[model samples]
Target: MKPIFKLQNRKLIVIFGLFIIAELGIEIGFTFVSARTGFYFVLQFSILMATLFILFLIERSMNRTKQELTKNKQKLQNIFDTLDVAIWSHELSSDTLLITQGIEKLYGYSLEQFYEDKSLWKKVVVPEDMHIIEEREKKLSIGEPITSTYRIVRPDEEHRWILDRGIPIFDAKGNFVDFTSVLFDITHRKESEERYRSLVESLPDMIAVISRGKIDYINPAGFKLVGSSSAAQLIGQPVKAYLPAHVLEQIENEREEKKTFEFMLNRLDGKRIDVEMSAMPILYGGRSAHQVVVRDITQRKKAERTIQFMAYHDSLTELPNRYRFKQHLSRILNSEGDRTVAVMFLDLDRFKIINDTKGHTVGDQLLQKVSQRLQNTVGDEGMVSRQGGDEFIICMEDISKEKAAEVAQRLLDVFTSPIAIDNQEYFVTPSIGIGIYPEDGTDEETLIKHADTAMYLAKERGKNNFQFYSPELLDVSSRKMELEGGLRKALDNQEMILHYQPQVELETGKLVGVEALIRWLHPQNGLIPPAQFIPLAEETGLIVPLGKWVLRQACEQNKAWQDAGFPAIPISVNISVRQMDDEHFLGSVTEALEKTGLAPRYLDLEITESIMQNIERSTDILSRLKELGVRLSMDDFGTGYSSLSYLKHLPIDSIKIDKSFIDDINHPSNQGLMVKSIVDMGRNLNLALIAEGIEKEEQVSFLKRNSCAIGQGYYFSAPVTAEVMRKFLAEGFVSV
Candidate 1:
């Protein structure tokens, strides 16, 4: 058949037809001359007939070939329309271009629309790919083939990757004129690759692939675990370099069905890590490759160790638990303890006070401080264990009774110096009890019991001390139990009473106020002074309710006196530090005032200086009380270790000098000097000062001359019942 390009010009096809006719005429003449005379006629007839038949066959074959070529061209046009790829053609000579119908669906632009403005192709190509396309096009000008992958922007504002293969079309003169190309849609393939990459990189565990005894590919997760930069750095590296010796053998012998192996691995940073690795051998890139997944177990192992520690040790003090302590004790007794072994039990005194008044946060801090001190005191010579809250046991091996006593003394001395927490200093004392091995009993149980019993004896003898174990001291434990049982019902039984001490104005001899002091009037025990039962009240947290009772009763008494036409004097009441820290403290005070109908100025609250100095939460309560116009006084002032800086800032109306100083007022020049200094400090700071426990007239005279605003002591009268005070007030003052 004829060439396809020849069909483009009808005149050229006509010229080809004429040339074929000319060649056929020459062939016919040559055939006639070559034949013999006898066969000339028949041969000529046959030849003419054959020539005609051949000529008809040639014309029919050409027509059939032309029909087949037209069908192929139609098929190609159909393919260009139906295929997902967009086909584009360009004339390099004229810079003209054409696009298929697929461009409208893919890029929201019709073929005709793109052909109208040939520059649309250049504009639609992504800016980053424009230079690349131009460079490839320049290569095609030098008779080079053009193939490139570029990002194209669709009319719908979508981006896609396209693999464009284009070839130059040359004229008869061998001059490049046009280019035809097929663009295959590669966006789905590119998107699939991106998704695969993200899936591998985002895996929680490390992943690696090895082929031909070398690591060929490792995902981003694997690179991070192996501490390498990229897969290129890892590829071609021997897999045995990172895996353990046993793991390497397992990898080579991967014929077994077992797919998982766990072992250690070395990172690029030269650190060994515990890893659980699973791998499978598979065909990859026409070669055997291993796909590995690894999970790091180092942190998990450390967490297990931490849980083990918590299971056997005290969290507060970081000391050995009783279980471990007992084990150590058994070993010590079995090995080499022929000499006496002392087990001392230490119980911290008034630790509950700090816990109740200052809060558990401060209490915990105080406990840590005490533990540090105990640890330092018993260093290297004994084993200390926390038996439980505020109770500790120290085992001193190879020691006599004398040595035990020495150790106990050393332990007691540790508390003499102050313990500071949160910028505040606290004084804590522990009552230590000692029980000697073999003397107190041979075994651990009996010795521990004896030591604990001795601790009870030490506490009974008064706190801040120590005692040795004895069989007789165990008897006192029964008494303590009985006391604990009775204390719960003491308040309900009405065994409590309040006695009023008159607080008169020092300048005017007039009864300006009365201080309410609580006394336990037990039915069988007679009158129990506050010094005896107040501590019990505080320790049992019965003080919060007890103090409230005292406040309500005291306020009612003052209100009754005022309603009865007696002179209305502000009644002072002592407050426990525990009451100050209660969250509902302000509500309690307001309720008391509203129930009693007593003016706020008619009530006074007496808090110890220690309470003011220790209570950080007191500011809110103090401010609330001042807002109500209630009088606030610091009781037992000189006895507290209050900072002068804080003393100047407290919201108080007055300061009461402690009874201790007043008792020794005349004993030395320094005692008088101390009283004078306090008086001067109070005056300088604009604080009203009251002196208590003034039994002698000389002390009273000294206080008066020093500008003390008030004085209360036996010099006037001891605390009396409320009825006696009402009678005494009506009958006028009774001198002692």
Candidate 2:
């Protein structure tokens, strides 16, 4: 469409042309007709009519143009109304602002308000975003295009995000004329962005965006994860600064796919931490980049290490366990070359006695001390491991039997000095046995077996010593195994028998009681002594049932003699610590007495001084026995290191001086004095004294002189069969 000014100028030119044409026509007619006959007048009238007609046509065309312009302006207004955008124009010449009706939809203001007050649009802009409008105005004054985004608050107190874009118009003289701008409502888009930012900021794991190998954006979690105080500290930093070169290369190589990796992350604080990272390709800032999420796994890694350590090491001593020791031995044996590998099997001597008496807490402490000593004694020479209980196995490669022996001696020597546990000095000793590779059998099992056998031999040969594996040791081990097997079946086969030893009054020469002793008569091996099989029973845990059998048998036999019209006498039955520790021990004793129809007063339960180790428990057990109307005597009284206070508290009717003291009672030295002191102490405590293992008359006389009344030994009669004991019972007295 043409401008109004141009249209008006065209009309004026047409009218002027028509006037010139009419004047020319009149002049030509006057010339041709000599100014007569009204010819000029007629010509002027026709030209004037033609000019008027042309003016009419021009006026009609201008009307049609105006109509079209109006229609087009209406269509543009409709288009602006359909979109969520407001269009406005400012004319610098007139100082006027023209805005579309859509301005009401965008700013909650009508066109009239904007026209009445151009500053109203500026006032609606949020205070923080007013700077954007000011900057855009400055750019527009310089004839520069304006494109800005800012927030605005409408008259209804509602906030909105606006995207304002404009193009500056200029005049022919290069002076700024006006600017037409379009404003779009972007509140929804801004809300979405805020939600996403909120989600990222609140996450516990780190989120980062990388562009061009540098950190483009990082969440709050990322800042904390990398030990950065602010975004400025981490932004624009190369991803390579945090990630290792290999990790970056891996991420770059697989940029198109999502992947996770676990590695040590170097923190900004110079501490390395375990981290799990997941990376995926993303469009950051409209360019291909990577988005990574990181999690710290330092605690998880530490827990894993702890679990792994627990799997291979003993919890109590922190030493390699039996499983680990076997693994070490197998590894050495598998790769053994022309070198001698010595496996030393060590068993703490009498460790069970200490463990049972002193309680497991002390036992555990002792074992820990032994483990530390073993490690120190064999430092760098071998690997020391606990084989459960008080047993330790050591492996030394490229060592000779002599070297092993020397190491074993060092181990024994280390324990020679007392170990201090809970303010108490304990004299613990180790009996170590050495087994050589290729000589003491080939494989781990055979070598360990040989070593164990030699250890038993060391124990048997008066403990606190070390011995090397020999063929002779295997024979002894085989005999022991045979004895253990035979002992298990002895009770069921009725191969066990009891012998009664007379307990006589040393001064009166009268038999008062008899001690029941267990004898195993192997069907094939003849009679086997208690020393040969009793320890085997205890080691195998068969003593609990065996002691019950002994108690019942002694009770039944004594009852039989009483029913047979013989003299009534109490029978002594030995009780093992294993039986004492049994939970049903009291029940067993009750059952034996009830089933045998034996009076409780005719029975005596013999306990050794070792019971004093657990004084409280011992007192309770002995007090209960005393309540059952049975006599309790402490056998081997002086051997167990029982304190005088312990003896005072225990409820015992008698104290049997152990044979070790009795054998030296006649000697003219401190030996007799020791026995005399024990007798005197027993007398003062109101405890009956009985001397065991008295074989000579002089020993008997010395015991009688010391006021020890009761005695049992060869001096009376050896442990006799029940049939022979009946004759002794009938005889009633033996000549002392």
Candidate 3:
């Protein structure tokens, strides 16, 4: 059947011969039919028709078979064309190859284009990848199956990547026939890998891949840190070269705990590295491996040490801080044997005056200079520290009480000469206090407290001096602290009250106004004077709040008196130097007036001449108060150091003569004429003059003669409560 299917010419010859035979038969039949019967001719025609129909059926069947074969072959070709992978085959004997149209999709080429030029494969392949293709083909020809990757240049000159896998084919005789290969377009995947490779190469941390206990790959950062010329120089190196036995032990110890370890690594140039390492198990290069990340921590360690130093020392002066000082003192106190240690507390007097007058920049430089002098004075025998602010502490060991005094004197003597700062000379006087261990106190806190108390004693004796701690000074401080505590509780407990003293016109004997004063009534103790706690409030910054409270109550009470149908005499409230300069002073005054609905004209702010210390600030504040329609009076007039130029510039409506000048108005000393001079000055300035502390008619007579009209003292009326003052105002214009 196979031979017959192949016999094309023979089949055609057979068909022609059959047709001739048929023709001869038909002719003979026709000759016979002419002489024979009609039945014989009809039988011969039927036989010829039967033979023709059978031949036509065979031809139609063959044509249908041919069409089916063509359709099936086209279907197979379509399947190959649809595949994403190119299926190709090479016949080594003919040196020809067959490829699916998928090659057109993979390499931008058609089957004809590939076959039309036998050298097309080599021509399209990039020069760099040509050897890879040759090697892959050689492997396939030798019956060695292989998978390779190479780049190709398309017709448009664009480079594309291909993954070619070759499988050898064999005949029944076991001889290599050809090779079948499959190609996949891996351009996108290769491009993605190249991007990631670029990113990995740019990392700053040392990243290394270890496989089979050997260094397999490392990034550029890793190569640089290891002091290698190229990545190849370190590849395949044993891990033991970097991580020694001790380092491995450290890593093992940290594995379960933190997954990180620290070690010093030596570079190829022999420079040691302080680094922290973290490792994770990973599968790399087709095997179990470890990915290690190393970060250099030398700078971090240096920063930590700097922070530690900053914690215990002052940044500005570079002296031991309070914490370090206390620690040192504590160690000295806790010593086994009986040791004589002196803790000296030295504070510079008038420091704030200098600091506020000259800016903080000059103050800071001055402090640095002072610290240098102190360090030079103390040397190594004692530890000196800037406890903070303008205060310094000196710790001396095995020193006698007399030696403590000598050291304190030496500290004071260091500042006798004025030190120049920013081209300005500043004279500093230090008050030093000495406390001896086991004598003044046994512990650190107790000794420190005693030293502070003695420091105050030196300031009292006169600044620029020294004093040893005495038990009596401790008692005084205890009482002072107790008073401060009571004062704080007094405000909250409603134990504070205001008292008003009537001011009267000297000759007319008519009520002018009253001064409101604060008095504390202790629960256990009797009435406490303002002199006892006012200074404490000023020192501790409590005056700001206390002054606000006082001002509020005075305004509200005066309003209440007027509401009760009493005469609306102006009640004066004393404004302190600190309060006048306070940031919230104006706000407090405004709030009090708004809250109490008190008219501003009925309120009078009385200030002492001491406020002239800061003349500009005082003038500004007074002008603002005057704008509110409140009257301003200068109290204790002759007591301050303000010049006549400043006096004329003040916004004061009146001047209150100092009680000191009035007390000795009739004295034989200069006081007799001083009161008259003040009166003349006030009159000349067109300012009203009021004299206070007039206890006698003679004092009143003197003031009246001096042209001073208003007077306030025990002669008029002592300070009384609000209720009493209300009765006094209702009666109207009382005289002493």
Give the best candidate by TM-score: 2
The 10-residue segment with the lowest total lDDT in model 1? 1-10
State the TM-score for model 2. Answer: 0.64
Model 1, residue 190: distance off in Å is: 3.4
Residue 688 in candidate 1, Cα distance off native in Å: 3.8
- Per-residue accuracy of model 1 over 1-736 as CA lDDT, tens digit each: 2355564465446546755765575566558755565665555466556656765676676677778898987787678667666777887788867676666655557777788877776678899988888998798888787888888898677998877887888898989998887777778888998898789889988877776678888888788888998878888998888987788777777853547766778999999888888888777788777788899888876787777876767888888878777777777777863677899999998676555435568888888888889999999889989888789999989888998898899999989888888886777799988999888978888888899888877898987788889877756666455554565677799777889988766666667678898887767768867765677678878788888888988888888888888877788999878888777777788889999999999898988766655556676678779999899998887665455677788788888887766765786424576678779988998998888887888887788888887888888889999889997567445455
Rank candidates, lDDT, best first.
Answer: 2, 3, 1
Clashing pairs in 1: 107-155
C-alpha lDDT of residue 604 in model 1: 89
**Model 2 agreement with the true structure over 85-180: per-residue lDDT tens digits:** 898888888776778789899998877888888888888888988788889989988988978999889888999998999899999999787879
The Cα RMSD of model 1 versus the native structure comes to 9.0
Residue-wise C-alpha lDDT for candidate 3, range 1-736, written one tens digit per residue: 2233545455466567667877787777777676766866786777678668766876676667666666875786687566557877788777768777788887787779888875676688888887898898788767799999999888888898888888998787778888788888889899999997788889888888876667889999998988897899999988777776776655434423436777887788878878888877766767666778888887887788778988999989999999999999998888789779999999998676456434467778889999999999988879999989899999999998887777777888889888887665677889988889888998889888899888888998878898898888867877889998888888899988999999887777778788899998999887988888899888877788888989999999989888988778888988888898789898899999999988998888888767868998889888898888888998877655546788899998998887767876776534457688778889999999888888888888877877788889988888999888876787777655
RMSD (CA, Å), candidate 2 to true, equals 9.1
Clashing pairs in 3: none
Provide TM-scores for the models.
0.58, 0.64, 0.57
Cα lDDT listed for each candidate: 0.79, 0.86, 0.82
Instruction: In angstroms, give how far residue 284 of model 1 lies from its true place.
Output: 8.5
In Å, residue 465's CA in model 1 sits off its true spot by 2.7
